[model samples]
Every structure is written in structure tokens, then in C-alpha cells.
Target: MGGGEPGLGSAEVVQQPEQADAGSPAAGRLGLEPLPYVVGEDGAKQPVPGALSIFLRSGTAAAMCLDSLAAAQPGAPPFLRIPKEKLLADIQLQGAISDFHPIKDAIRAADCDALAVRPNLDDAYGDGNNYEVACSRAAAEAWQAVEEWRRAAAAEAEAAASAAAAQAALPKSKRRRAPQPWVDQGTEAEMEAVAGPPPRPPALLVLERPLRDLVASRQRHQRAQQQQQQPPQDQGKPASTQPQQQQQQQQQQQQQRAPRLVDVDASDLWSSAQSECRPFKDPNYDTRRARREAGAQAVPRLAEKGVQV
Candidate 1:
């Protein structure tokens, strides 16, 4: 018999007693009634056919009873009874008539030995029909599965708790702050203006030229250039006296030495070198505006080509 079909056998139908014993295993203990047939058209009941029918029904009953017991509800009656008659019938139907080996095999397959009803469980001397069953193999196995599931759930919960505790115990400085709704978000340009422009890169100094010679040469060139560029304010006036010329020369030397002492000469050299070395003006000085104009021009071309702009 297949394990899924909940039907009766075709050989012979066993007749149930007119009056069943109130505490007998023939009556369900798990508040369940045996479903031996299915409802068909016109409200007629049709008998399900197969030896597997009773086996499946008995297995289902065993499962339900175990589930109730596991719930451990307060003030609930203990589950100690099982349907033995159905299990026995299933075993007999599936077992071979001759050798007792088939019956043993069927009993093992149906798990009937563990699930069958026993009358004397609470009291060995008591009538078997009025007490809990002796062996509950199916229930034991079901409870084991439930226990495993509970252990897994408990482990997961413990891991989560540990993680939360670790996070809570972290220092305030190390903890991440959530975004504040009251904080104002300004435009990128405004934010950049507030932060100020980034510092410019340091000037590159060439080491090939001797420092003394480079400085002296540059100073002389600057002095000569300044003299040529200066307007002749006293072209018709007499030349300066020897003492005055000497004093003027001393003042110019002092001005040059003062800048070198304060370390301003290097910056001066950097500025002058950069301006003299690079003279070309950039064509796309306003890059963002240029990009906008290019995009605007492309729109007309795309429209002329029958493409969406």
C-alpha cells in the first residue's frame, strides 16, 4: 500500500461494534474521529480504498496527540492514549498471510509498536483500556524534532542579544550618529564658499642652479628691469650727489636683505617664475558655461535629425 492513500481494503470490511467501549483504543483519544470516507456528489459518502488508509489515519492521529502534548498548555489533560485497532488493522492488511516476518516488517514500517494503544501505563495492574498507552515512539520522535528546532531558535536569539549588547556598550565617540532632520542642507556652491578654497600646491624649486648665483642673478635682473620701467621724473633735473647715491644704494640693499631674512624671497621667485613661464590664456576659462553652450547647440542638431532632445 502507498503511504498517501487514506482508503480501505477491497478484500473484506471489518464490522465495528454497535457499542464501543468508552475508554477503548478503538475510539480516538486526541479528540479526532477516523475519516474512512470522502464526501462525493449528492452528499453521498464514498469509501477510500487501500490498506494505506488506516495506516495514514493512525499516523496522523499520533502526530496530533504529540503536538498537543508538546504545547504543554496549563491545566490541560495529559495525552496518554492512541488508536491501536486501526494500527493493528493496517499491519494485518499489509502483512503476508503465511510467514510472521511480513507482520513484523509491517509493524516496523507503520511504527505501530510505539504508537499502538496500551491500557496499563499509569498503573501496571490497571485495565489497559482505562489508562495511558505504554510506548510512544512516534511522539518521542516528534518531540525530538521540536526540541531541535527550539535549540536552533534559541541559539539565533542569543547571537542577536550578544551583538546588541556589544553595540550598546561602545563608547559614545565611536558610535555612529543617525542623520538629523533639523540640519540644513545647502547648495554645493554655498557649502564650498563657507569651507573656503583649498590651499594651492607648493611651488617646485629647481636644484640644478647654485642658490647663491641664482639669487644674485635674479636680484640684478629685477633691479635692471625696475630701472628701465620706472618713469623719468627728473630728466631735466641735476644728477644726485655722491653721498645721496651711496645712501640710496644702501637703502636698496637693505630692502633686498630684509625680504631674504623673512623668507619672502622664495615666494617672490615662485610667483615671478610661474607668470614668466606660462603666458597662454585658456580658451575654456568658464568650463561650466562652455559645457552649457555646447549642450544648447547640440539640442538643435538633434531636433533637426528627428531625435528627442
Candidate 2:
């Protein structure tokens, strides 16, 4: 084939020969991966090499074709092991080949089912491809659950901090406790054994005198006083008998009464001189000689005027 551009009806335009410099691992695994073939105006298959670049840009049509070919031809080349149903979904979504009327005529002519195509994920983003790999449903759901749990944990921590702040804002209690006196274990045990304080003595027992003895002494004194204050009473009598009775009564009264102290008058001048009372002195006291003989003067009488004897 010449370097000149191929006619629109040639199948060789979409066929690719492998190139090590292309840097596609999938292409390296097999020969070169071809683009989709276009249809000519005469209902002939015409390969368009530009279809591969288009599939790489918009969707996974190249990967779908490679995977389907690998399934159909097990001995062919390396491709991703995607499920058959996923492959059909890729084929159905990728291009709707019927939209390209020329391609639709060519596919219908070959009796091909466009709905049965599948794609390999590796071929889409593997090697030099910069596309992000897609995750499965279960994996995505698990990541979402992890994110939710993390948020819940953060919320719980925030709630705990807020509750602590609120608790700290409350007023402290003002109640104070009475100081307890310290006691040794031995002393406390003894106190408990005794139960309470000792019993008190009775009031009667506490008195200095007996109750009966006090009452008897009080009654006797009252009777003696009453007898002394009263006057004597008598029946009618003769004069002599009355006089004798009166004399006897007088004698009895005189005997009962105590003698009164009387002082005799020493003013007769003939009476003998009475001795003066001596002053009392302490036996243990020592007196000075000058003070002991004080006031000891002799009495003197003057001589008579007519005779001096």
C-alpha cells in the first residue's frame, strides 16, 4: 500500500499495525487495536482509522470491541475480563451505530448485533491513559457509609464539648461541712462499748440530812415555842389556898427562869480596890526594852498645908 490516502471503500484504513512507541499496553498485548470500520455508498465496509481516536475521547468503544473480540476468540489476545452484561451495556450506550447511516448499512449487511458489545476497564485507563478508574456499586456505598460514620463521630465530639461548657457555666454549691473532731480507734471503740453517759444520782440521796430527821426536829421546836407564849388558866379557890398556890407557882417559875447578871456598885469608897484587867500579849513576840517599861510612873501626894509629915 502506498503512503497516499486510501479510497473510502478500503477496509485497510481502519486496520492498524503494532507500534512499540504508541505506549498502549493493550495494543502491545495484541497487534495494533483497530478503529471501527465505516460503510461506503455501495454497502461495502470501509475502515476509518479516526474512529479509534473518537472512541478514546468520548467513550469506551475501543475497549468494548477488544473485550468482545477476546471473548469470541479465546486464543486471540489479552483483554479485561468484564462481565458479558456490562459489555452489552457499553455497546448499547457507546455509539448507537444506527445514527451513522453508512455504518448501520454495513453492520446490517454483515448481520452483526451492536447490542452485544462490552468493554474492559483496563483498556480505558491502563498504561498511558489518564482517566480515573471507576468503582463498583458496593465499593462506592461502603465509602459513603465510612464518610457518614466520620461525620457522626465529629458531631458526637462537638456535643460532648458543648455539654461540658454548659456544665462549667453552672454555679457551685455554697454548702460547707462541719469539721469533724479526730478520735483514736481505741477511744472510739471504748465509747461505743459504754453506749452513753453514766446515770445520775437521785435527789434524795444527794441531800446532806435525812428527810425524816429534819421533819422531826422542826415539829419539836414549834411545840416548845407555843407552850412558852401561852398564859396559865385555873378554877375558883379560897384566899389562903390561892395565895399558897400562887407562891408555889412563883417558886416554880423562878426555878425555870435563868439568873440575870448584876454588877455591885464599888462607889462606897471603903470598898477594896478592884484589880485592873491585864492586856494580852503574844507569847512568841519579842518587844524592845524601851517600850516594855513605858507609862510605869509612881503616884505622888502633896504635903498638908498645916503639917508636913
Candidate 3:
């Protein structure tokens, strides 16, 4: 037909479909042994296994079998084939899966046919066998417990406060009384009661002038006698000598009696006198004074007699 295409036109491609071997290891492990086909409600032939069919019939049985399988093979995917009726019964008996509302709602939503509808006609008519009633009862019990705890705590707090106030209010000692004013009235009355009538104050005795002059004269005579008994100093001294000295001493005493100025050198006079009267070099100088004076007097006599002076 076309130029130089004789062999190309004669060569036709042959095709063959690839088939999986039933004796392969994957097939044997997966138990993919040509599942018994069944016609579904839609009139389609679907693969159905005996084990899967049994699991669908009994949820508890399916769960047990899956648990055993998972234990045997650690890396196996989880199997979920619980029957609707068993799951609903479990949900009713066990209550909500968790306290979270959203999780319960999601579970209800996902398993609507099993969980959303009432268990029986009585529950649907609101005969009080629902999850809400159980949750409400639990809440009421919790609130009651809370109120009891609060009341107990308040009572305890009040008791403690009252005890503290009582302790604070108690007097420290038994001798509690108001302070009394200091007065002699109480003391005077008490003394008068114990000692009978009060004693009279002594009368002022007015002495006559003559008796008063007589008492003065007796005092003067007694002072004169005292002066006579005292030893007298020499009176034979010249008036210019001893009398002047006495007058000078009297004047000096009178000057000393005058009020002292604050900035006086009284301490300097005492210190200077102390320095002048230094103790003798010989400690026994006072004891040896008699012998020394006697020896000196004898020396004068000996010198008069032409002995070695």
C-alpha cells in the first residue's frame, strides 16, 4: 500500500493480562484464598470471608479475635468489625466514653444508627433512662459535696476566729481593776480607826521676857565655861606680831568665804604644795631625829672643851 512498509504492516502486537499467583507468600499470609463471593443488596458480587462474616455478627467475639491476632503479630493493622447492636448496648451500660461532651457528640455522630436513637421505645418517650440524667445526678452529688465542704470550712474558720478573739480578750492577770488616785484620805481614816481618837497638837508655850533672858544668860555662861576649859595660845606676844598674824588670817579666811570665780587656779596651788613637800631620802629620818639633835648639842660642848670639833 505505502512505500517500504511491507514488514511493518504485517507485524501485529499481541497482548496478554498479568495474573497473581494464589500460592505466593503475600497471598498465603493475607489469607486471600479466593473469598466466597456473595450477591449484596445492590446485586453486585462482593468478596466475603467466613471470619469477617462471623465478626460482623458478634462484636465482642470480633474484638476478642482481633486482640489475639494483634498480640500474635505486633505490626498488624487494627481490625474494626464490631456489630451495631453490641456497640449500642456497651455504650448504654458503660455510659459516655469520656466526660468531654465533644468526644461523645462525635461518637454519637459517627455511629448515628447505633448511639443517637433511643435504646427502646420507653427511652424515646423520655421515661428517664438517658445519659443526661446520669450526668445530672453526678453533678448534683458533686455540688452537694462542695456545699458541705464550704459550710464546714466556714464553720471552722469562724470557730478559729472566735477562739483567737477570746484568747486575745482574756486578762493577763487576776488583779484587774481601775487605778485609784493617790490621796491621804484612805490612809488617815485607816490610821484613826486602828489607834482610837487622834492626838492633840502640842500648844505653843509663850515664855515671859525674864525667863527668855535667863535662858540666854545660862547659854552664855556655858559657852564661857567651855572656852575656859580649852587650852589657850600665848597671849604675851606683841600686838604687832601674833595679833597682826591673827588679823591677817581672819582677813584671808573672809576673802576665801567670798563666792569663788569659775576660772580659779585652786588645783594648781594644791599640786605646787604637793611638789614642795617631797618625802625625805631616808625613810627612818623621823625616828632618828632625837639621836641626831642630841649628838649635835654634845658636839658644841666638846668643841668648847678644845676636843676635835
In angstroms, how far off is 241's CA in candidate 1? 14
What candidate 1 gets wrong by more than 4 Å, as runs, is: 1-112, 116-147, 172-309
**Native-to-model Cα distance after best TM-score fit, residue 60 in candidate 3, in Å:** 42
Predicted model with the maximum TM-score: 1
Which regions of candidate 3 fall more than 4 Å away from where they truly are? 1-138, 161-165, 172-309
Models, CA RMSD each: 20.6, 41.5, 41.5
Q: List the residue pairs that clash in candidate 2.
A: 64-118, 87-117, 87-118
Using lDDT, give the best candidate's number. Answer: 1
What is the lDDT, from 0 to 100, of the residue 180 in candidate 1? 35
How should the candidates be ordered by TM-score, best one leading?
1, 3, 2
**Model 1: how large is the Cα RMSD against the reference?**
20.6
On residues 46-122, what C-alpha lDDT tens digit does candidate 1 reach at each position? Answer: 33222221112334335435444434554333433445554456447655432222233333455443443221223
In candidate 2, stretches whose alpha carbon ends up further than 4 angstroms from where it belongs are 1-134, 174-309
Q: What residue pairs clash in candidate 3, if any at all?
A: none
For model 2, state the Cα shift of residue 105 in Å: 30
